[model samples]
Target: MTIYVNGRFLTQPTSGVQRFAREILTALDRELCQSPALRDRLGPIEVLVPQKVEAPGWRRFGLRHVPGGRGHLWEQGALWRASRDGVLVSLGNSGPLLHRAHVLCLHDANLWEIPQAYSARYRLWHRALRPRLARRAAALLTVSRHSATALAAQLHLAEDRFRIVANSAGHMLRLPSAPGVPARYGLTPGGYFLSVGNRSPNKNLRALIAAHAACGSKVPPLVLVGGEVPGIATQATAGGGRIKMLGRVPDGDLRGLYEGASAFVFAALHEGFGIPPLEAMQLGVPVICACSGAMPEVLGDAPLWFDPNDKGDIARAMRAFAHLESGKRSAMVHSGQKQAQRYCWRESARVLAQAVAGVPYQLPAGKQAARGVFGSESRPVENLF
Candidate 1:
């Protein structure tokens, strides 16, 4: 069987979905090269990406462009025609051909379910294209059970149409910061509460800033790691001293920020599954997260949970986290490490490989088979893995 993976997401920088795509593809490549069973069953994999973009390290495959340069016209028309020859799987939503037995990894239904959290353009795009994508996909893959339920409820997809493949901690997990690197960025060795991601409304940055202000002297300054300066300029703090926006740091530096932070904070209103919190957990950083959405699902009881809507509640949680004794902090770190262990890129790749290989993909009703696949079973799906 020829399996073509849409690699557009891998070309982008490290957002949650981009990270998910890159890691899974890398893992799949490694498995195919190293594992005899996977090599025999899957044959060779092909990655289809936008023209001119290169994935430097992937071994057995190379890049191919969809003909035509008409932008969205090309994605909707030309790519569909180009992808008709094989089983195409899109890492991001919106696969090309409707009739070609394609699998789509739909990260979230947030744009449809919680339109208020997104910008007008985003809402419009989701409204127009997402339903069509959901309807056309042969099977669906999502990062969490929450997302699966949301996709079924919002898009009216059958529960059996979707599967859950949780996100994994990156290659940086548990790795220590490079020596003296913090000094180069003018950061104190252990000075700030690290917050990664964009300043979009759904990320709840406004409330996070409010809570940071409310925390007074108890918490350290908040350090933001990614997003465009021009797009988020309006949200910048007045003095710009208390809030440090480092923009896009390289993967190595980001791991340093994760390792050396006083604590990691995430305030997103919703997520398909929160990856950064788990990233923090794997690094042994204490985490403070909002109670809503998939944050609780990802963090469990490991982090300090707060109501995202209430600035006062978030402030209280930060204050409590600030005063935690050494023993309590260690316990939180230990719990977070355990929680982070439940997810892995190799396992995620195996599940995706099975889906791509046509291994009787089925999604049973009401969490029966869903729980079995995504639940406490850490063992890889025997036949596929």
Candidate 2:
């Protein structure tokens, strides 16, 4: 079977959805290398990209341009015309509505679950379109079991209809550390708490700020990686010089930030399946995560959980993590790395390939499970000696 991928995500900014699409596609191409026989299952695959934009090159997958404009119009018209003949795999949670043989990957039902986090237009679009697309697609995929349940209920579809293709942290290991990132951010290795970045109100940034304030100067200084800066800017210095927000950063700088942090703090609410904490885990960082949404389910006992809804609770977790002994911290890193190993982009892409090929899912030989070797070289910054 010939698989045509919706490469539109390459043009979008790197959000969770875009990140998932890119990683899965990248892994799928690599999967072709691991199992040459699998190429016969899915061959002559073309990533359909928009015109005038440079498409990502893959060893196995070919890139084809769909001419016209960008965004919804281009997807509905040019993209549909290009892939209506084959099994179109839309990784960015959407595809041509009329295309019958299609695969749609939705990360969550956040718009339905946390309606307040989205705008009227954004909510309305998904509310109206996703259900229809879910029913029309040949296969449906989600990031986690919690998300599958939430989406099934939200879309009025069967829970068994969705396949789980989880996100992983392996991608982080590929980027080399940016040497001057710590100095540029006025940071020192093992001397700062790193918070995962997102601008959404549902991310619970206000509570994070309040909690970091409560930690005071006793804990290491708190640094946020990427998030909205407008409203939070006024309160950025509210921690009495303990809080620092770096806004959005390049991937290399992010890798450096994750490597140097004493502990990784995450307080986002209603995630489909949080990826940032896993990224930290891959780098051997201890994690303090919010216990809401799919995080507890996805992270297992890898992280110290805190109530994102309560600023005091968040502060308590931070304090507890800060006071942990070196031995305890080592245990946390080991547990985190082990937990993060369960999800692999390559494995997820294999699942996707079988679905796209219209074949009954087969566990490829030697691919029974992901050993998750990406972070095998990792150790906490303090233990680097």
Candidate 3:
């Protein structure tokens, strides 16, 4: 049967959610190229979006834009009618509430877990909408096992209702080396530390800044990426230019940033599934990740870990990572690459295709059996990698 994708994510900006949608769709196209079995089971994958709005990467996939409403109105009106007869897949957070054959990818339970971190309006909308969507959806897709567990617990639903399809760093892999991009950012390979994300409180940016300041002037300058700056301007300025804010950057520039950094630092208190660490690992950059949430489960032992809550611990971890011998750093890079390979966009697409094709659930293929791939635990339906 033909699967219609909810094109709402196309109207959104290029954040983690949008990135996941784009990468997965591109990979799904590639997967279809290699798997004739999948082709027989699933018909043409089509995306239905609203007309007149510019969708940056829509041309990369099978896009069909219908003229009518915009935003949620379009989703509820045109999208609902378009997806009435087929399986509708909403890769991002939201979907039409009335659709029953819909598969919704709820990236995380952060809205429920850390309600205070989100604005009142966004939190209220998600709180009201998601539970109902979860109940109505034919199946739920999430990025990490941790998120699946957290979402199941928070929604008071069975864990089998959710499938864990992890994210991949394939988009940044094998890119043309961006020589000028690094120069534009005033960075040198292996000369600076890096962190990316918005200024949300849950990102713990202030704590990361505090940790950088405590590390003293001898450490490499800490570079903050993403569009949101938060309240760190004063502190960043007072540190005698120890912190460099690059603001939002283009996708092409990101690979250069990852390749040039001494180590990537992710201090977020919670993530549905941490992507930056995998991005860094894919580019052969060492990573320092927070011990909270899914960092441990996703990155495995490939990264140096620290407590997101304790500024001292973060500082200490950075310091130790900086002082690691060359031999050790190379070892970490090798191990990280192996860990990064465990996740692939094509694999994610195959699993999603399986779900869309109404096949029985199964874990993503990996280093071992589904049981070992998902860390020795099997769920009622099937374990997700």
Give the backbone clash total of model 2.
0
lDDT of 2 by residue, 1-385 (tens): 4568888887776777878888888887776766655665455788888865565667888888788688767888898889876668898877788776778898898877777677666677777878988987878999999999999998889999899989999999889977567878788887999987666777777788888888887688888866542211122223337887787888999999898899999998789999999899988999999998899888899899999988999999999988889999999999999998988887887777656654212223432212321123333211211
Better of 1 and 2 by lDDT: 2
Q: By summed lDDT, which 10 consecutive residues of candidate 3 come out lowest? A: 230-239
TM per model?
0.89, 0.88, 0.87
Candidate 3: list runs displaced more than 4 Å: 53-61, 228-240, 359-385
Candidate 1, residues 113-188, lDDT tens digits: the string is 5576665665676578777877767677999888888888888878767878889885665355674666677788
Error of 2 at 256 (Å): 0.7
Separate clash counts for every candidate: 0, 0, 0
Off by over 4 Å in 1: 97-99, 174-176, 229-239, 359-381
Pairs with steric clashes in candidate 2: none
